[model samples]
Structure formats: C-alpha cells, structure tokens
Target chain A: MTMATVQTPPKISAQGVNVFYGDTHAVDNVSLDLYQDEVTALIGPSGCGKSTFLRCLNRMNDTIADCRVSGQILLDDEDIYASQIDVVQLRARVGMVFQKPNPFPKSIYDNVAYGPRIHGLADTREDLDEIVAVSLEKAGLWDEVKDRLDHLGTTLSGGQQQRLCIARAIAIDPEVILMDEPCSALDPIATAKVEALIEELKGGYAIILVTHSMQQAARISQKTAFFHLGQLIEFGDTTQIFTSPTSGRTRDYITGRLV
Target chain B: MTSLPNLKKRWGRPQVQRRLRRRYIYERIFRMLGLAAIGVAGLALATLIVSVGKNAFGGFVQTSIDVDIYLNPEDLRPSSARYRHDFAERVESADMRKLLADALERQFPDIDTDSERRRALQLFSLQARRTLRDYITATPEKIGQTVRMRLLASDDVDQVVKGNIDPRVPESDRRVKDKELAWLAALRADGRISRQLSTTFFTGGDSREPEIAGIFGAIIGSVLTLLVTLLTAFPIGTLAAIYLEEFSPQNRLTAFIEVNINNLAAVPSIVFGLLGLSLFLSILELPRSSPLVGGLTLALMTLPTIIIASRASLRAVPQGLRTAAQGLGASPMQVVFHHVVPSAMPGILTGTIIGLSRGLGETAPLLMIGMVAFVVSTPNALTDAATVLPVQIFLWADSPERAFVEKTSAAILVLLGFLLAVNALAVWLRQRFEVHIPD
Candidate 1:
C-alpha cells in the first residue's frame, strides 16, 4: 500500500458519536476526522457499523423514525445540530450516495435540478444547465447522457443510474461527498470507472466512503478508518492502518480473522 | 489482461432433456374453473342489465287523459269572504279534486254515480290535483278560463300497457271494480286512454305514486353531496397520510392514530350516518335532507380509504428518493411535496376516485339522515331537504303501485350511470399518473 503526503484541517469531525434504533445500539461511540481534498474510507465486515457511522457524518440518520444519535458532529468546527444551524443548509454542504441507485422518477435534467431548485441555488435556467453539465462531467456520466437530458432518469442502466445519482449529489454543490458502497452493486468495469471518478473528485471535494472491499480502500483512500462491532477500532494513514494497525481488532479485520 | 488467468476451456454438451411429466387432469379442471368464474361474473352483469332495461323502459310512457283544468274564479277564491289573510292560507282550504269531480259530472252526463264514474277519474294522478293548486297559486290571472291539462292516470291503467292489467279477466277477479271497468271501456271507446312519452317522470319529485315519480332531484342531490365530500375528504385525508408516513416520528401516539385509521375503515357507513345525524344534523343543526349532512357522512366514509391509499403511495416512494432529496439539502417538507408526492399521485388519485364512487352509491348511511324523502321542487342549496339517487330508488321500490316497480329500475339505471362515469375518470387519472419503476 502507498501513502499520501499532505496536511490540512479536517473538513468535518465527529466526537464520541453513537447511533441507536430503539433498544438496538447499531454504532457505539466512535470519533474520526474527514479532511478537505482527501478521500477517506471506512471498511470492515458486514456488521462492522461502517455504513452506520458514515451516515452519522451527514446526519442521514435523522430520516429514520426510530434511530437516535448522541454526541457532537461538527462541520467546519461548528456543531451541526445547534439551534441556529439549519439542517437543510448543512445537507447542501455534505452530500451522500448509497449502495443502490435511486434516481427520481423524472427526466435526467429535472433530477439534477431538484436539489438546486429546492435550495434556490441556480438563479436562472442557464445557471441550472451549467450545474447539470459540470456535475455530470464530474460523475463521468455526461458523455453518455448528454443528448437525452429530458429522458427519464430511471431509464438508465444500473451503472449509469449509480453515476447519475452521484451527479445529482454533486449538483447540490456540497463541500464533502459521502459514498456508502457506491460500487458494490456495479460490475468490475463500472467499479473501476467510479474509482477513477472518485480519485478525480478529491481535487474538488472531501470524500468519506464506506465499503466492504479492503483493496478498494487501499486503492483510493488517503486515510482509512476501520470499524468493528459498532466501534472505530483504528483510523490513520491508509497504509499504516493496513500494515501496522495499533488495535488487535483492527489487525484481525484486515487479515480476515475478525469483522 | 488475463494472460495467466486464462485457464482451460473445454466444450461442454447440452444437458440431457428432462422427462416430460403430464400434469393431472385436476390442473386443467381448475384452470377451466378460473375461466368459468369470469364467465359467471359476466353473466351476472348481463342479467342485471337485461332486467333493469326491461323494467326502466316501461316507466317513460304516460297513461292519462287531457282534461279541462279550469281556474274556476269563484271556486279558486272560496267565496272571497273568510279569505285574504294569506293567499296560501286562503288557497289551502280550496279543493281541486272536488272541482275536478264536479266538472266531470257536469261535462259528461253519460257517467253514472257508480264505480264507473270513479274509474274514469282514476286515470288522473292524485298529484295532478296538487299541480293544479300550485299553478293557480303561482299564477292567479288564469281565473275564468278553462285551461286544458294533461292528467296522469292511476297505476292500474299503467298495468294495462305494462302487461299487468288483464283485459280478459272479469271485473270480479281483478282489483278494478266492475263499474270502473265500464269507465275504462268508455275511455277506450273514446280513444282517451292513450300512452304518450312521460317527460314529467324525469322532472317530478319522487312519490308513492309511481306515475308521478322523478329522479331529477335525487340526481342533483347526489352530485352536490359528492362535491362537498370530495372537496373536504381528499385534502384532509391525503395531508394526514403524507404527514404520518413522511414526517411523523415513530411513537406511540402516531401508532395509535394508525390503528384507529385502520379500524375506522372497517366501521359501518351507517355508523357514520349516525355520527353525521348527531354532529351535523342535530348538534350543528344543519337542515335535514340537506347535502351538507350527506356530504359530512360520506367524507367520514372516504377518509380512511384516502389515508390508506395515500400512505401506500408514500411508501411506494423508495427510501432512496428521500435520501437523495435530503442528500441535496432539501427540507423534509420539500422532499415529500416535491418528489415523494408527485411519484405517489397516481395511486392517491385512483384510491380517491374509488372511494368517491363508493360514496356516491352508498344508501344506508344517507337514509339514516333523512335523505330519502318526498320533495317536489329542486333545492337551491345544501341546506334544502333533498333525496339522492339511491334514496329515490328506495322510495319508488316501496310503492305499492305497479308503475313504481319500473320507476325504481329507472332510478337504478341513473345511479349506475353516475358510478360508471366516476369510475372512468378514476381509471383515466390512474393511467395518466402511473410511474412504472423499471428493473
């Protein structure tokens, strides 16, 4: 594994965050930092709470009716849930993608315009068109879907749909983008395309990705966080986390002895 | 690429053909039975159409004679002495039937004092007398002239053309007395007993006398009630469903509401009628036979349907879409109203329409609130006492007169027409809004 040579304040930070649904504690207390212009990955076995903790970063857990979270989650060094903070505005700053592609049942153009339209980001039609174009280009979906902007978003292929969702997320112009197993549902070729797009996206946006693939974390992440049984076992430079994990659980997870 | 990994490749033969086992004869029988079930449904529909068509077609013909409807100035005024406090009060004591009988005796000397004379007057509908009184009260200027009027005959005369009245049977064997038969014979001799198109059947109010019954008022009542029901129920039910499904947190209170909604759906509509009778008619003191009361009852009936359907539509919107909206920084309200609802509209509309159509045909609940009543004039407002289509049919069905059987069938046809029209609209909207999520 290789390592990146850079130093910057994290774009977001979490401190002792734990998530629970009713009586079930899905994510135990965990802390981590996501830096600007760097790709961070969360990886472990199926029940390691990697996805649960990733959701904690952007407050996606708020959508669950029973899911509750305690502990501070900070964006730009400000408490996200402070009385003065607006969740709507906060979400615009931190976007997300999921394992399964779910595009709005509307045209490709409209899907891209949804977030911007809701938040009043684009003032004119031309401005909206520009956002759509740039976001699609960044997602590597523009060339394939350029001619059919009015076509239904759900009509695209599975891989294309995943990229379309990415484009939609980026169209909101967020500072950080989180992907939860974005390539798990795609084939190898699609995964490689998404991997390349992620590498390019780091230049413009901070990224916190959750995946079950160790090789993928090794291939794309600058810093890696390993979770096991609802705990953040270890987090550091991606190479060190893989080669010299400080915790036994982290080492066990890396070597496939525990998850 | 894949140089060392490109291992061995051997051509494999196609797998052996499996044995073809024949299915049991019972399988074929069950399949045929399924088709037969569809046939049974078709047969039921056909039978209903045929029966209603035969009966309703009989109601449009008039069996009455043209008689002189005089505004006998002296008879209409009732001596002018002991009158003039109010025209209605003055006219209330005036009798149109006595005037008609006296005119008949004076006009036709051949008619005797026996059943023969009485049978001759039987052709005139009892309601025709009320019409005469109303006409004079509305227009008092027709005071000395003998205005000609088309009078509706009795139900027995209607039976003659409809095949219920037998000409061969002796007077002693039939309901009509012997002398009345003589009057009918005389009318037949004079060609006064004729069958003409009964346009009044569609204009008059429902009555115990089948010959005078009309469904116009009831049809209008149903339309007005439905307008009120849809306007109120759809918005409230859909909004409640959206809030509960999309915004409300998981809690005991919301769950209690969810359970209550389900239970309310199963509650009898007559119970709703009781509620409306208590709440709107008595408690609120809205007028009886008013569309307002009917509408309130039907709205209660339709609320559960709309809520269930709207929730299903909301649930149909994948969680990923909401996440997508929130991912883009959309507020919870924006996510629901903008994307979730639009996707769910097709289902919501379909469910709403079905609920409305069911409301339209409902009878028991409306009956409980005094919607089934005899009203002669069309109501100008919801507060006016009026009857709906089903209530009109119910009124006519209970009439002992032979013609009411046909009137009931005609009213049924009109109600069915309304249901069909509403159902068609539902189907069209459902198709228009359906968004098939592709695999």
Candidate 2:
C-alpha cells in the first residue's frame, strides 16, 4: 500500500474484473493495479484464478470457447475489452510466457524473430538479426545460444527454452509481460537462473507473474497479491504481505495451513 | 468381521489361488488369440502374393520364333514413288502376314499340304506381322535382303511354352492342338522357338490377343486420373479441413457437416460411381470413358477420406502451438496457417497419398463412367477414352481366353506395385517432414 501511494499512474489497472467459464465463476470480481518498472506477482494455490486473471489483462481468455469476461481491464487507461480495440494489437503490447516452456518448433533465430516478423517491427534482415541478438541478450540466453542460432528452439534445455520464450515475448518490445509459472517445469538450478533473469529484467518492463511458489514472489517481486478461491485476499508490498498479511486466509496460506 | 487377520486368512485360501490361475489362463488365451490373428493375416497375404506371382510369371516372358525371310520387293513395293512421301503407309498396307506365312513355310518345308502349311502359320501371332512391318519401315534399304527377325508366337504357343497349356492335358481340352505342339517341338529342337522378356507386354496397348496385350495404356490412364484427383482433392480437402478444425465455429451446422463427411467416407465406392454417372457424366456432360470424368468421379470418392485424415492430423497438432502463436499477436488465420498447418503438413500429405492410392485401385466407380470400354489405342488426351489399371484387370479377368488369366494377374501385380510405391512415398514424406513437438 505504501508503494501504491507513491506510484505514478498504474500501467495496467483491472477494475472489478470477472471471468466465467460456462457456469463456473473462474475469476470472481478482483481489482488490482500493475505499475511499470516493477514486478507484481500473483500468488495462489491451484484453481485460485490467478492465472485466469493474468490472462484477462491481454484478453488471452477470449481464445477459450466458452469463457466470458465482464468488467473492464485498461492498459494506459484505455479499455482493452471494447469492441473497437483490436485484440491482436492489444496482445502485441502485452506478451506472455507459458508454464511448460513451449517454444515454437523453429530455429532459435526464427523463434525469437517470430513476433517481430509478424508485427513488422524490423525493417530489414539486419534489423531482425540485431533485434534477435538484443532480445536474447536481454533474456540472458545469448551467451549459450548465439553460436547455434540455426538450431531448433525446442532442442534447448528446459531452462534455455524458457529463456527463449522470454526472448520471444520481449522481441516485439511489449510494454507488459505476463508469465504463468515459467519455471515450474525446471530444475532448481534452472529456476534460479530464471529468477536471476527476472531480477535483471524487472525495471525494464511491467511484469505480472502468476506463480505457485510464494518464495518466488517474495524474492523477485516488488509487490504481491494473494488470491484464494477466485478472490484476491490482499495486495501490498512484498515484505509486508509475507511478514504481516492483513487477511486471515493470506496468513494461513503463508503459514502453509490453508490447504 | 473384516479385520486385517481375516483378510490375510482369505488371501491364503485355495479360491484366491484358483482365481489367480484363471486370470493367468485368460491372459494366455488373449495373447494366443492375438498371435493367431497375426498369423492368419500373414498367411493370407503370403498366399495372395505367391499365387499372384505364380500366375503372373507367364505374362512377363514371351515366346518367339526366329525366322529368316527374304523381303520381296514386289510384295513390300517400297520402291513405289506414290509411297515415297508416306513410307509408313506403305509399311502399314504391305502384306507382312504373307511374308510371315512364307517364312513359316520355309521353316517347316516338310509340311507340303496346303492345310498343314496353314496350321503351321497359325502358330505365329498376328503381332508378328506388325513386328516385320515396323522393322522394314525403319530399315527400308534392307528390302530384298534376307533378314533374321524374332517374331511373337501365338498366345497358345506362348501358353504352351510357359507351361500354362499342359501338353499332357487331353488335346481336346486345351487350346494348343497336338499338331501345333509337334511343330513347337520341331521349332524348339531347331533352336528357333525361345522365351525372352516381353517388351510388348510393357510397351504396347491392350488387345483382344493376350500375346500383345499390355498394361502401358492402363498405367497412363491411372497416372492422368490420379493426377487430376490429387490436384482437385488435396487442396480442397486440406482447406476444408483447416476451416472446419480451425476457423469454423462449433455450431450445429458445422457439427452436421462433420457428421456428413464421416458418413461419406463409409459410403460404398459404387455409390460414388452412381453419383458420378448422374452428376459428372449426365449433368455436367463431361466425356464418358475418359480420364477426365474418371478423375472427377474418383475425386468425389476420395474427398471424404482426405478430409477425415486431414482433420485428424490437424487435430493432432498440439494446442499449445496455436496458443503460443495467438499469444504472439497472430490473428486466428495466421495462428493456424503459420504454426498449426505447417506442423500438420506431413500428416496431411500421408493422408492424401493414401487416398489417392485407394482411388488408384478403385474399379466400380470407373466402370460406371464407361471406363470399362475396349480401348485399343493409347489415349492422347484427358478427354480420350481411357481405362484405368483396375478396369483393365476387370476386363481381362472377364475374358474367356486362357492367356488373359496370366495377363490379369500381371496387371494386378503392376497395380499393387504402384500402390506399394505410393504408400512408401507416404511413409518417407512423414518421416522426412515430421516436426518433433516435445511434450
């Protein structure tokens, strides 16, 4: 709350957003603000709607056949769900990394260059190469994969592929990056690498991370929101939320008693 | 009553051991049945190949008699000025059969009577005349020269040489008469009658005479028809599949369409023939008995197979790829075309090839469109009257001539070779282009 009081205008603001999959209210009314130059983590147990709420920011939930969203999610104060808004354009501005390190079955260069190529972010081959290099450099994968740029992206290890996904997301210069458990499939060493990469990438983009690990949110995120059973229990600075949660559910969850 | 010690006591009982033994027996029975099923399938396939090969061996080699005949200038008249501009016409009109009859008379000079000499001439095939005509036309300067040529023996002679017409079988029951067999023996003793590779069987068109009947024309017809089918069915089926699986909304209409497509695959191929008879031949007024109509009819029959296979393969592409593409701001169309379709391409090609191979072996459909006609000349165009390999096989199979039995088996082998090649190509394509999507 102290960090929220001193912040500039929120980069992305969700106001009473609700999501329904058929008859199930997957994401109940939840309001939160994500600020630029900071990592905000959404931490919850499984089926708590943290991932669903994260997908709503860029309308990724729209791809689901029976899923419906109500209320407003605004990026830079512009409603993303309005009919006039192009979902393609909205997604270009807000990229995503998935849980399973799903890289396109393409060469490392093409995998990083895909978003740029489709969005026409690069004017020439040289520009594209430079963009791929810089994106890989930023994702902390350039040193490992620069020589084998022509190798298929999936041939990389789990951690490297996850980093490649991050590079793919950032290649388009997306303003907001959403990660859904990007390290859950990785070993502890790979997870540590990704955590370090996130630390290095924190101030450059508004990162909204949905993670099962509360310690990951505490270690890397500047702000944290705890969700339980499709409702946000509390939101605050990372230290305050971890040490002294205002909600009883948040305290129980933090103490490993909520299950 | 159900304490831990009671459960242990029940486990030690003879009933439990009996149930375990019964389970083992059931497992053994299931495994034995599986092995028996495989053995039956293998035995059936082996029997089919062996029988077909045995029957077809006669069709691949032809019996011929080497004859040296003096080409008389009076008969050929190659020196005529009227035939100077059209030498082929002279060769065509020339009485090559008379020359063959004269050559046979020279080979069997002992046969002095007119009826015996005529019977000796009957041992040579009518193709022998064409063989002389082609050679004399190609080398017109050799007129009046004694040329040693190998000429085709009659189908009966060919059958006797190949052991299809058993000499020991009563002469009344067989096509080769005893007198003809004696002449064949004389020719064989003279080292004039010999068996060589049958070039005519591979190069010539169909004929009423099985000696000159070949599958070349049928192969051409099949190639052209399959070309048309592939060109029509592949894109249409693949695009339709992409639309249904990717773009089409999950509504009752699309569901109904899906049901129809699945049902169409099971519809008897003859039903497609009838449809082609009414639609393409009757309503569209396309040329009957032509490759064009045959191909269109087959396309109709093959569309459901291609569509069903393509849809299944398209479905096999991981949903994660689509989500990843869409998450990168790709439009719905872009998501499918860029990532999904490319990943599914190997599977689509395999399906398309399998469908085409099925169409290749299809007969009843082509039969309905009048492709069962007796076309002697090779077709020069899509609209020309042409019969496919299966229809040719069907025609030869129906003939009363004993020589045609081997020809039928040979044609079947050719068709099977084509199918095997196509399936091998499908397997190669799948291996070559399959994108490994890690789970």
Candidate 3:
C-alpha cells in the first residue's frame, strides 16, 4: 500500500454493521472502509456472511421480508440508513451485480439502458443510446454485441449475460459498485475477461466484491477482508493477508484448510 | 454393504437379472395401465360427441313446402267500419291464419271436410301465418299478387322429414296423423317439399315451437355476460394479486385473506348465483334476466380464480429479476409492473380465459339471476332481458316436444364450441406473449 493511497479518506465506511435474517445472525459486527479508486475483496467460505455483508452496502437486504439490518453505513460521510434517506436514491448511487448473470428478459439494449432509463439519467434518446453503448464498451462487450442490440439479453452466452449485467450496473453511473460473486457462474476464459475489465474499472469507482476464491481476491483486489462464520476475522492489504494473515482462521482459510 | 468387486459380480448374477426383468415387467404393466386409463377416457369423450352429434344433426335442417298464396286485398282490409281511417290498423288486423289456410287448401284440393282441412293446415308451422303477414307488410304492392313462398313445416312434419318419427307408429301414439303424412308424401312427390338449412335456428330468437326457436338470442346473451365478467374481473383480480404478492406485508391478516380467496375458488358456483339473486336482483333491483346481473354474478365467481392464478404466476417470476430491478433503483411498483407483471401476463391471461370459459358454461348461477326466462328477442344491451346458451339448452331439454331433443343437443354443441374457442384463444395469447427465460 502506498502512503499517498492511504492518505485519502474512505468513500464508504461501515461502522459496527450487523445483519439478522429472522432468528439467524447472518452478519456479525463488522466495520470496513472502502476507498475510491480501489477494489476491496471480501473472501470467506460458504455461509460465512460475505454475500450478506455485501448486500448491506446498498440496502438490498430491505427486500427480504424478515431480514433486518442495524448499524450505520455512511457513503461519503452521509448515513445511508438514516430515516430521511430514500432507499431508492441510495441504491441509484450504489449499484450491484449479482452472483449469477441475471439479465432482464428484454432486449440487450434495454438491459444496459434499464438503470439510466429508470433514474432518468439520460435526457434524450441519443443520450440513452450513447450511455448504453459506452457502458457495454466499458464492460468489454460492445464489440461482440454492437450489431445485434435488439436481441434478447437471455439469448446471450452465460459470460456475455454477466457482462450485460455489469453494463446495466454501470449505466446509472453509480459512485460505488458492489459485486457478489460475479464470475462464479462463468468459465475460466470468461472469468479472465471479467477480471481484466475489473482491473480497468478500479480507478473510476469504489468496487466491493464478495468472492469464494482466495486467488481471485489476491489477484484483483487491493484490500482483502476475511470472514469466518458470520464474523470478520481479518482485514488488510491483499498481499499481506495472503502472505501473513494475522488471525489463525484467516491463515487456515488462505491455506485452503478451513472449510 | 457389498464390496465394489462383489457388487460388480452381482450385476451378472441370474437372481439380479431376474430382478431387473421383474422391474421391466412392472414398468410395462404401469405403462399399460396408463394407456388403458387414457383409452377409457377417450372412448367416453368420443361416445358423448357422437351421441350429441347424431341428435343435433336434425336440428340444423328444416323441411319446408313451397306454396303459392293468393293474397286477397279484401281479406287484408279491416272489416270494422268504425276504424276506417287506420291503414296500419288494417294491416295489423289482417286474417293471416285464414289466408294461410286458404293457401294450403288451394295447394291440396282433396280436402273437403273441416277435419281433413285442419289436418292439412297442421302440416305447416304456426309461424307460417306470421311469415306471410310480415312479407305482405314489408311489400304492400304484393297484396293482390299470387306470391310463391316457402313456408316452414311444423315440428311433427319436420321430424317426419328427418326420419326421426317412424311411420309405423300408430296415429294415437304419434303427433303427426297418417293423413298428414300422406299429404307430406304428396308434397314431396310434387317437388314442393325441400329440406334446407334452418336459417331461423341461427337468426331468430326463442319460441315455443321447436321449428322456429333459435339460439341467436342466447348466443348474444352469453357473449355479453362473458364480456361483463372479463371487464369486471380481470383488472380487479390482477390488481388485487399484485397488491397481495408485491406490496402487502407478510402478516396473519394477509395470510387469512389468501386462505379465504382460495376457499372462495372452491365454493360452489350456485352459491354465487344465490348471492347474486339477493344482492343484485332483490336488493339492487337491476333488470331481471339481464346480462348485466348475470355477468356481475359470474365475475364474482371468476374473481378468486383469476386472483389465485395471477398471484401464482407473479410468485413464479424469478426473485433474481426482482433483485436486479431493485438494484437498479426501481421502485416496488415499477419492479412489479414492468418486470414481474409482464413476465406473468401470459399466465394471468390463461387463467382469466379459463375462468371466463368456466363462466360461459355456468348455468345455475345465471338461473338464480333470472337468466332462465324464455327470452324471445336478442339482447341489444347489458340491461336487456336475455337467456344464455346453457339456460336455453336447459329449457329445451325440459320441453315435452320431441323436436326439442335435437334442439337441446344442438345448443350443447354451440356451448362446447364457445368453450373451445375461449380456451384456444387462451393458448394463442399465452404463446404470443410468453417471455422466454432460460432456467
């Protein structure tokens, strides 16, 4: 980590956040800071609350009937869970890409333009079109899909659909992008392409990713948080965490010994 | 517990082979039972269709005899000197029955006694008098001309022509007398008797006489009733489903409402009719036997079905899609209306159509709403007195007239045709609007 990068204030700060799904404490007390122009990877075993914590950032947990979220999550120092904050507007500034490729059952162009159209970010048809084209390009999919923009989003291959979802998240021009295992459903080649796209997108927005693959966290993220059984075990630079994890559980997880 | 090698060897054993053969035998027997069940069902349906078809064929064709009637101006003129200035009254009081009797006498000169003359006139339908009068009224210049017109045969004569009545039956046992049969034979031999499609059955309204009774009024009534049902039930049911599935919080009250809705779907349709009888007929005092009341009654019956189906389809929409839309900052209403509803529309439409089809065949509820009345005119509006096809079939099926047997069957076929058309439309709409999504 460079001294200059460490000097910048965090773009988003979670202070003592917790999530409960009905009677189950899914995400225990966890505090983390995500800086602009950096990729923060949350790595954990299955059922370790990595995805649950990722959902808390944009208040996606509000959709669950029995899931309750507590503690303050501030985006650029403004409390996101404040009663005055509109969840819809909060989500517009914080977008998400899901674990699986979930493109709307609509045309490819509409899929990419969904967010911008919903938020009224584009003033004209040409502007919306330009936004869709640029988002798709930024997701590394414009060249493959430029000619057939009207095709159904679902008709695309699994990898292309993921890219389309990423483009959808990017279309609204969010300040923070949260990804939950975005490449888990793709092949190795598609994963590489997505990883490359993430590398190019790191400096433009604060990215928080939940991944099961430690190698993926080490390769694509600047900071890494290790979660074990709904609790954050360690948080530090990705290289240091991989080389010398402070917590024994984190070291066990890094060595593929703790399931 | 066997080792792998031992298990592999066991696969080649004779006992294992016998067990495998037994399993195959069981599978074959299950397949045969399934086929037998299907064949039985198919045979039952075929028997129903064939019997109904055989009985209905006679209802579509009518026997008629061409008669040259000498329209005398003196007979048409009113004999009342007190009403000398009324031309319309002159036309209204025309002796049409006498005119038709004279025409039949002219066609058959062998009739001397009043009894024979009466039997001869019985060969023509009672409506033949009205038909002749209407013709003369429509073209008054033909009042003095000998116009040749084909007149409808009575129900007995029609049955005789269709070979439904056996000539060997005694005169005391049959409606048609031997003498009338002989006159009909003569008419047939003279090339005056013709069997043609019964346009009256498709064009005219209900009547006491089977020959002139038609289903047109009933068809219009059914259509109007179903339209009312669709218009009232679809939007209300769909919106209710959206509210329950998307917006309502998960609580005991909503759960109770859901259970009640499901129970409502299972309630007997006749119960809805009784409710309509009290609520719409007795209390509200809407027109009796009107399609408006009947449709409202059916809409009540259809609402629960549509709600259940709509909610089921809405629930079937992938949660991932909802999450995706929400992630893009779409409101709850927007998520449901734009994505969930569109994806579930085909299913909702299919359910609505199925409900409507069920409404089409419903009889008891409509009967309770006074739709069982013998309506004679085609209903022009929702408030007009009307009877639906099933009620028409019911009325015909209960008549003492033998000709009504075929009319009943024919009405059944028309009702079935309507149901088939509705279900086919449902299929077409489902296919046209279904959103294709990979699992």
TM-score for the A chain of candidate 3:
0.98
DockQ (C-alpha based) per candidate is 0.56, 0.80, 0.85
lDDT of 3 by residue, B34-151 (tens): 9999999999999999999999888888888898898999798778664555666677787787787788888788888888777877888988887887888788898888999999
Best by TM-score: 3
lDDT of 3 by residue, A1-259 (tens): 6566788889999999999999999989999989999999999899999999999999999888899999889999999999999999988999999999999999999999888887888999999999999999999999999999999999999999999999999999999999999999999999999999998999889999999888799999999999988899999999999999899999998898999
Clashes of 3: 0
Off by more than 4 A, model 3: B1-5, B77-91, B138-145
- Model 2 collision count: 0
Chain A vs. native, model 1, TM-score: 0.94
**Model 1 chain B: lowest-lDDT 10 consecutive positions:** B11-20
lDDT of 1 by residue, B1-439 (tens): 6466433332232221121223456678889999999999999999999999898888777687656656676776745556666777667778777667765665567777656456556757787677777877787777688776666677777677467767678767777666556666666687666777887777767666777777788888888999889999999999999999987876899999999999999999999989888888888888898998899889999999999989998898777777877888888788888878988899999889888998988998998898877776777798888888887787778877777888888788878888899988988988888775642
Predicted structure 2, TM vs. truth: 0.95
Query: In order, what lDDT does every prediction score?
Result: 0.83, 0.91, 0.91
TM-score computed on alpha carbons, candidate 1: 0.82
The best candidate in terms of lDDT: 3
Task: Provide the lowest-lDDT 10-residue window in model 3 chain A.
Answer: A1-10
| Fraction of native A-B contacts kept, per candidate | 0.83, 0.70, 0.83
TM-scores of chain A across the candidates, in order, are 0.94, 0.98, 0.98
Model 2 Cα lDDT, one tens digit per residue, A1-259 = 4655455888999999999999999889999998988899999889999999999998889888999999888899999999999999999999999999889999999999999999999999999999999999999999999999999999999999999999999999999999999999999999999999999997768999999898899999989999988988899899999998999999999889996
